[model samples]
Target: VARLQERARLFLELATQRGLDTGLSRGSAVIPVIIGDSALSLRLADRLFEQGINVHAISYPAVEEHKARLRFFITTLHSPDQIRFTVDALATTLSELRQEALYITPTN
Candidate 1:
């Protein structure tokens, strides 16, 4: 689980830094973003399927196939030590990805 949380944080931070449109909304107009194919919104539906909170991957036409992902969550329910461990794991994973920019930077 620790591994999962870090990946989530890293993904979240990258998304914010890129200013990619959540694409989860109707009025959005930013770099397209997606999760489960209904736009990016994941509130009530998420809570209802708490046990199924797998990933937030984007779909095809709008995105590509393998690009799809499931989402994991972090909350008060998890301990700080656990969160930190997961963060470290995510950093390691991101470093290994090699082909993608973690975030959009000028000249990137």
Candidate 2:
């Protein structure tokens, strides 16, 4: 458990430094990042899954309003490389999405 927590700390720190909106640290095994868009959240989750990381995307109605997010669980079986890969993949996916203008915008 300690090793997993340590790895989670590294991931959370890197994610926070990249300006990702991660929720307050509770030292729990699950790390939650608010993605705002359900579609983007799911896509990011799928990207991570493709890289062999298991995560889940939570959308409105599944949780309270405005809480859409991708939830990543830290397990003892995960290696440092896997954690780094997941974070890197997340950064790459978001960057690609942004460059592609795939995010929704206000219709006004």
Candidate 3:
């Protein structure tokens, strides 16, 4: 479980560094990238799927509305390279979505 925690920590740090939210993930194997918009969450999941990452999209009912997110589960089997690739892919995909105007950045 220590290995899993470490992987999760790495993923959280990398994702947070890229401006993605590692929501409610306190050393847990599950890391959630909160996207806020349900449609954007689903689109991000689909985009990641196209890049061979199988993350799940959590939307309203599963979570509160406007708190939709993409959920990633980290395992000890994942290597650091894989984690880096996933984070890069996620960031790229999100940037692409933003460029396409499918994602609207939320104002604080």
Candidate 4:
């Protein structure tokens, strides 16, 4: 449990430094990176999945609306390198998605 907690702390710090909203962590194994938009959250999750990182995108009904997030679980089995890689991938993927959103025109 201690190792898990330590990894979680590291993850939170790295994620926060990268501007990812990780305000839902309590120094536990579970860390929630709040994206605030349901579509963005799901896109991030799917993008991460394509990159081989599997995490759950939590949205309304399970959590409050507009507080959609990707929940990350840090375990003892995960090394520091793995955590860093995951964070890097998440940041990159999210940035890409935000950039894409900027140019998306409404069809209506």
By lDDT, the best candidate is 4
Q: Rate the local accuracy (lDDT) of all candidates.
A: 0.39, 0.80, 0.89, 0.90
* Tens digits of lDDT, candidate 4, 12-105: 8899889999875776888899988888898889989998898999998788867889999889999999999999999989999999999999
By descending TM-score, how would the candidates be arranged?
4, 3, 2, 1
Model 2 earns a TM-score of 0.82
Error of 1 at 34 (Å): 9.9
Provide TM-scores for the models. Answer: 0.31, 0.82, 0.89, 0.94
Q: By lDDT, highest first, what's the ranking?
A: 4, 3, 2, 1
Q: lDDT, candidate 2, residue 92?
A: 80
TM-score between candidate 3 and the true structure = 0.89
Tell me the tens digit of each residue's lDDT in model 1 across 3-65. Answer: 445444544554545443333432211123333333222332343244332333344554455
Model 4: pairs clashing at backbone N, Cα or C within 3 Å: none
Best by TM-score: 4
RMSD in angstroms, all models? 12.6, 2.8, 4.4, 1.0
> For model 4, what is the alpha-carbon lDDT of residue 100?
99
Give the per-residue lDDT of model 2 (tens digit) for 9-91: 88898788777778785687788888877777777788778877788999878966477788888888888888887888888
Where is model 4 poorest over a 10-residue stretch in terms of lDDT?
A: 22-31
Number of clashing residue pairs, candidate 1: 10
Evaluated against the true structure, the overall lDDT of model 2 is 0.80
7-105, model 3: which lDDT tens digit per residue?
A: 989999999899987777888888888888888889999989988999999999899967898989899999999999999999989888878874556
Better of 2 and 3 by lDDT: 3
Once fitted onto the true fold, the runs of candidate 1 whose alpha carbons sit more than 4 angstroms away are 1-70, 99-108
lDDT agreement of model 4 with the native: 0.90
